[model samples]
Target: MSKVPRVGIGVIIKMGRKVLLLKRKGAHGEGTWAFFGGHLKFNESLEEGAKREVEEETGVLIKNIRAATFTNDIFPKEKKHYITLFVIADFAGGTLPIKEPQYVEKLEWFMWGKFPKPLFTPVANLIKKGFNPFKV
Candidate 1:
């Protein structure tokens, strides 16, 4: 294992007044709601990673990308740590599909303050920091 903490890119894709969130499974935050994202690759800028991840995983194209916030997420039981850069992007256009069925159970958009319960660690952490994507 790379002993160093892994860097993750979490994209908060928004449309209208709702934010896109996916139900995670077979991972640390299993069954929890979170944004679409993945590990950041070498030599990639934050915006680059944010755009690539969303397009690759959820088949969603985003534009007007902005740096929203970040979270230091550590899973003690799994012995894993990731410093996730959470970025906000408006939903440009796409036909949503459950591309990675193994990891994603489903996807849905929710209002700002009415997000579903049991969010993935990083997202929950963001709320604690008071970062609002809609207002950004």
Candidate 2:
């Protein structure tokens, strides 16, 4: 476990009344649903990190990206701490294919009120705070 909190970016791709979600596979939040994102690479801007993660994980391009909110996700069991930055983005293009199958089990679109069970910790924390990405 690192001494400092790692930075992560989460992109909430909204289309109509639904948002994209992915079932995690081999990472820290395995078996839980999360947005299309991952760790911010060295020297990458937040927007760049979000775009890269979305494309790398879901083979999708996103646009109109803006900072949404954030959550302090600490998993003692996993010995991981991440300051997750949430960004709201619109689906610009690309097919919804699971590019990184090793990290993601599947992808799906869901309404905010009808999210799948077992959400990733950061997302759950956001929800607990009543942070609605749809609300402007």
Candidate 3:
């Protein structure tokens, strides 16, 4: 079988002391809480993809992105995906609708210790490590 490569972007958005979390819908981690992100489009750079996804999924424009985490998940029986994750801060943009309806079922800000359970694996891993959702 031939191998296929996939690239994805994830962003950590912060508002003061709280971090934003989105509830995903109809995708790999559907119904799970996660950061704002999505797959990269053709010829798009990682940073570009991340910026676009953050806005598309959360309606937030990320101003500062620091390279902090990288994850590669490979499935021998399926496909391999390379993910570029960033810790974003100091953003300025319009307030997102209470809910994004299609991509996200809900959007909420939570303090690390107070975040809800069952976050998508990647985000959960970060939170578990006490990774400052804001700091890179």
- The 0-to-1 C-alpha lDDT of every candidate, in the order given, reads 0.88, 0.90, 0.68
State the lDDT of candidate 2 residue by residue for 94-121, as single tens digits. 8988888999999999999699989999
State which candidate has the highest lDDT: 2
Off by over 4 Å in 3: 1-5, 74-82, 98-100, 128-130
Q: Which pairs in model 3 have colliding backbones?
A: none
Off by over 4 Å in 2: none
What lDDT is reached at residue 115 by model 2? 91
Lowest-scoring 10 consecutive residues by lDDT in candidate 1? 51-60
* Candidate 1, 1-136: lDDT as tens digits: 2489999989998899999999998777999999999999999999999988777777788999888778988888788889999888999998789878888989998998798889988899889999888776
Per-prediction TM-score: 0.93, 0.96, 0.78
Select the stronger candidate by lDDT from 2 and 3: 2
Over 36-76, each residue of candidate 3 has an lDDT whose tens digit, in order, gives 87787989776787777776665576777666675554434
Worst 10 residues of 2 by lDDT: 53-62
* CA lDDT, candidate 1, residue 60: 82
Regions of model 1 farther than 4 Å from truth: 1-3
Better of 2 and 3 by TM-score: 2
Clashing pairs for predicted structure model 2, backbone only = none
